[model samples]
Target: MAHIVVLSGAGISAESGLPTFRDVGGLWKQYSVHDLASPGGWERNPQLVLEFYNTRRQQAREAQPNAAHTALAALESQHRVTIITQNIDDLHERAGSSNVVHLHGEIMKARSSVDESYLVEMNDQDIALGDLCPQGKQMRPHVVWFGEMVPMLESAADIVATADVLLVVGTSLQVYPAAGLVDCARPNCPITVIDPGEDVKVKGATIIRKTACAGVPEWIASLKL
Candidate 1:
């Protein structure tokens, strides 16, 4: 079977009604997500950061996987599918994709400040101010905040490098490290980009300019995979 690696971004979750990180309006208009999503911001006001992610987690919990997510999961029956996502949400896993690597960490998990290995599942809910890990340290969102190194980048890159086919979904290919994973794919591997936006700049990629919900299922149907 061919190895298919998929790189998903916030756009996939956006179709399920989860807010995109960069979109203006709603809570974003009231406050910049960047302010609450960085280590420096966490230090200045951990409460604010915790509250922000708490709200995001609640939203993610209430959201359901959309057509794109399901189609990607179904592709596993015909191909070896591995998903590497920048999304903090678990929509991919909920959609039944067995293999997923979260480059941005998961909103449904919390980690100990003292020990990186100490992690606890949050069940897609809140991590309050006083929440502590077994190590007796304050718990922090497991996410890879801005300015923080993405620990999963190397692994994701390796997966991309070995892929027989690569699918770029929803993401604009803007963010670092994670965005750069596309560069790791083998020179001759076929690449496809699915997004509603115009003129995505992935050289030699076949672009499907449509929303993830509409484009992914259509693409899969065409492939008969």
Candidate 2:
């Protein structure tokens, strides 16, 4: 079966009502990135950090998978679809795609502040300031923060290197590490870019120049799937 690798980001989730970090009405504008998505932020205000993630997790949970997600999931019937996403949400899995690699950790989980391996499901709707992991350390959102290494980068690159077809969706390829994964694609692999942003570019790629909701389904239709 052909391997289709999808590299997705926040813009795709934005269609589902989950605002991107820079969007005007999202949780991000209410706080500073240093206070909500960095280790220093957690250090200065653990309570704020926890609260920010709790809200984000809640939003993700309530957001339904969009048409782009559903279309990607449907591709699994005829081929192997490996999704490497920069977003922390599980919309792809929720849409029925079996193989997903989150370069950033999942927001629905919690991990020990001091121990990376001590990760587990966050059973509550919110993580209180005093919430502790099994090791007695404060539990922080499993999502990757600024200044932290992306643990799944190499793995995702390997997946991209093996793609029979690669789809760059919703991301502008502006973020590093995750953005750099596109360079790992095989020379002959078919490249497609699906985003309305004029800045979205991939050398030699077939650009759809539309949002994922419109472009992805159109691409799938072309495949007759």
The best candidate in terms of lDDT: 1
Per-residue CA lDDT of candidate 2, range 44-63, in tens?
A: 99987887788888888899
Question: Which residue pairs of candidate 1 clash?
Answer: none
lDDT (Cα, tens digit) per residue for candidate 1, span 1-225 = 889899999899999999887662466567665688888888888998888888888888999999999999999999999999999999999999999999999999999977878898988458999998886889998998888889999989999999998999999998887889999999999899999998568999999999999999888787633
Clash count per candidate: 0, 0
lDDT of 1 at 225: 34
TM-score of each: 0.95, 0.95
After the best TM-score superposition of candidate 2, give how far the Cα of residue 33 lies from its true spot, in angstroms.
1.0
List candidate 2 segments past 4 Å from native.
Answer: 24-30
**Model 1 Cα displacement at 142 (Å)?**
0.9
Note the Cα lDDT for every prediction shown. 0.89, 0.88
